[model samples]
Target chain A: MGDNMSELLNVKNLKTYFFTKYGTVKAVDGVSFKVDKGETFGIVGESGCGKSITALSIMRLVPDPPGRIVGGEIVLEGEDILKISDNEMRKVRGKKISMILQDPMTSLNPVFTIGIQLEEAIKIHQGLKGRSLRERAIELLEMVQISSAAVRYKNWPHQLSGGMRQRVIGAISVSSEPRLLIADEPTTALDATIQVQFLRLLRELQEKTGVGLVFITHDFGIIARMCQRAAVMYAGRIVETGSVRDLFDNPSHPYTAALMRSLPKLEEKVERLASIEGQPPPLNDDIQGCRFAERCTVAEHQCRLSYPDETEISDGHFVSCWKF
Target chain B: MQRYIVIRFIQTVITLLILSIVIFTLVRMSGDPVLLMLPETATEEDYELMKSQLGLNKPVYQQYLIFLFDAVKGDFGKSIRTRKPVILSIKETLPNSIKLVTVAFVIGFALSIPLGIVAAVKKGTVWDNMARVVTGLGQSIPTFWVGLMLLQIFVVWLRILPASGMDTWQHYVMPATCLGIFLMSGVARLLRSSMLDVLDSEFVKMARIKGVRESVVIWKHALRNSLLSVVSFGGMYIAIMVTGAILVETVFAWPGFGRLAYAAIVNQDFPLIQGVVLTAGAVVMSANFFTDILYAYLDPRIRVQV
Candidate 1:
């Protein structure tokens, strides 16, 4: 949907599968999305919904042997990263694109100091050393609003609180000044107030650097607050992709509609919240029909027999459902 | 850190004191060493004289108190067999055991860590499976048998290394290898699992996603974190090797504290046994102390204050 100049990342038909003992798990099955410069693209889904896997696939950091990108085009700045050698992909990873994971407590190496972890990305990408390196590290820390950054540089991950450690991680991810930053539920581990502060800080950083952001989370409130565009993933596929307002106000796909219904709304005196019935189908090699058919309230005979192709409903808004 | 160390040191002292009392009483209860020392034709009067001479006539608690006081000053009395100060012999032989254990430990660590890293990186592949098989054999096989087998293959068959006697470095090959194989298996397994655990952590994945080289990700990030458990295990391993190398030593006829301790045990050399036990206890305690310090160094969270 995006033109060449504005698009920072374009992931097309990305298929990352896990070859397990039981069967092939299509973790990210033909997921397509794009993020433009200075935009926040949110990917929302329940647990095991392949949103995080899609983000990981873009970085080419998927665990091999078990998990692999069977077919895909992750075009970061007009280069197809999947076709390039691992060595080439590495150069693109932190320097061109970086990620902040979910758990800050376990995301930073416990043994190394904050400065060392930050310098890991900076020195590799920027080649700064000595006082310049130290200053750059301090600068990055300060960028993330960590006061007394110089003193905190020597501290280990365990010494810091959850929110502070995450800030340090945020500092590390931005050290290379990448084109795009993927934050996979970065604020999920933090408390409510901290989450707001973190989101605000991220928005501030994004505005300062103009880096494209891919925010993956199940939280609807985050999508409403942060994302410009959003993709709703189900059974390893994007069921709906549109502007956040469009997806919230007018969900076309049955699965997206069900999800919207489940959200707890204030000022509504409902006795109980609506929830989608049944579980998402087990992704298997021989998945014959529409994965969501069994759970879909309006599923017909045809809907149970074949998968629904994506149909564009409005300007740049697409949904995959028989009803659509 | 200082307070923690002081508290740890006190605990070690108390532990050793309890161990000393246990060793003294257990060895005494095993039967009179004087009876074993005296000749078969010796009369009752001669037995009495030998008993008094060796201080076996004293009550058990009194004897332990005297031994404990003397042991604190590095005196473990005279060996019933050699009639030499038991401490002197243990001191003379301890360096040999230390040297052997050091060599073995170096060999074990050098080989096991690499093997472990490879196994973890190439996990579930043929290389990993091969490592598992080799380490499995190392874990299951007895040290004495391993020593004999090494002697048989390297000495008798290949004729590349010496059979026994600690005259040359060549003599250490068999026993060191025997000891090392067992330690290597443990180190390799411990390191492999540790590496796997660390490698699977979100931090390692984060490191990889940060464009750090795979080598750096594995060695710098993963291996260092994995080494925490490996180092702790190493402390206990060194203590085991110091005391348990008796089997390896006997098989290879290597002159070390283990062999001396073995001989002392068999000969019922009261003073020599006590000396060897004390030395072993001290060695273990020292290893644990260093391990604690290492723990603090490796993990900043464990660094105690005041």
Candidate 2:
């Protein structure tokens, strides 16, 4: 363990690439971040910006053949998970690190009972079974705020509402009481009202369990509501990283500035919301420079020539830009 | 669930009734059985006598009514060629046919599903390619040819097993294997595609994230969901095997309902043919009913919606 051994999960320079027939897809290129104990670290980016892939890579559950985690270390607690064997990694997953994926409607196995699915992690990690497992499953269901947990445990996934199913997923992920929980757009499929409630529930659960969370999403609104620290990801690279308040008040990177400008304001009235122009550059080969340079409003010749290194702006704020 | 079963049951009855009518009329329309049974040099007197004796003198509608009435009472009348009760002979041979088909179904599923899952898990690899080639051959080559080949190798050349008869379990090997080969390929292909679809589903990925072992993820989660298609396909395959037993029965000389039906068809035994058709129809209908129930149970959405 290092000086910041308290950091529950540290993903250092993670590089996950997809070797497809049409060339390589640099899904998560040298993405680096750390989620401290009991902290919510948000990774905000557009759909193809590799937020989910980063989460998957950390879990060591990335689909192979086309995708591979080519480099970098995923250090959880103390051990570097990337260096461990798959069998050992399986022990790490759900026990120390668990993930709640996107699309709650299809996340749980449809053929299995809610109880069986909830009990799966508990049984695997805790070795509880029979009456105790049943009790644990009921407790987990109730923990997620599902009414009549006993009855609901026997229900199939298709019988549950989207919100309820997502809660069940939350319950399953937390069953092992993992130190770090990576939630990849857990509430994206939920209704707006339900999303708030779910997020609040997650936040409360995290507070109660003291579990670190890697909240990955595209919505800045959710990032503001949930995250303590936030990173703005652009084309698989974290362009800016700081406390939510610092990032919101004074974003350093151009991409972060553009993102803040594009967000809909509550107090201010405008004819149209500001949107960053230009599509993100194709992440096929090794990118030479800042990915946002092409889309940047104030791009310089130096920005296009080569990639900029991360610069510490303040005590906790870091930005990657030549302009800084 | 009860309501669904009841509704399906009624539907099955209606379907069976329709099938019986079709079989009766179609078999009758194949031409006069008496004409076919009698010699070509038979006089008009012989034709009239045979017609009167066989109740061919009655109108078609009367004959259908008589047939339906007898069918309702579990009596399919006497066989035109054998002069024995049609139902009695069918009842005697039905178990053998059931046995053969059941064996085939078991063997097919036992081999196919695992192979399919393995192929799906190891997609695009040597195991997958080999599975594709083997299953493709199973489906493409004729069943009779396969049976003959097995017989030539196992029975004729090696002289290790009996070629025909159902007296010993050894006799069931060639016919069952031949029958199973066809179904095995179909089941493998179907299960492979279905397993691929299910393995690609979000639930499977979520299961892996839950720290579920790879075997549990594949066999428990992926396999269970994938089985919906396999089970349905299997039900249809069973019904097909029951009816398609004719060719296999003839080739192996297995004394099943299929062999009896084959003989009936050649000898113009209308009552016997009708009995076999009616039995086949019932088997198909029941299989469909069970499959629907199984499907609904597997998918709660279907259980609630339909």
Query: Clash number for every model?
Result: 1, 0
Q: What is the lDDT of candidate 2?
A: 0.90
Off by over 4 Å in 2: A1-5, B33-62
lDDT for each residue of candidate 1 in B222-298, tens digit (9 for 90 to 100): 99999999888766997779755899888888788999999998987877988998889888988888888888788
Candidate 1 chain B: 10-residue stretch with minimal lDDT: B297-306
* Docking quality (DockQ) of candidate 1: 0.84
TM-score of chain B of each: 0.92, 0.92
Q: Relative to the true structure, how large is the alpha-carbon lDDT of every model?
A: 0.90, 0.90
Tens digits of per-residue lDDT for model 2, A1-324:
565867888889999999998899999999888889999999999989999999999999889988999999988877899999999889888889999988999998988888988888899999997999999999988988999999999998989999999999999999999999999999889999999999999998998899999999999999999999989999989999999998999988999998889898989999999998889888896668789988897889998889899899998899999988
Worst 10 residues of 1 chain A by lDDT: A282-291
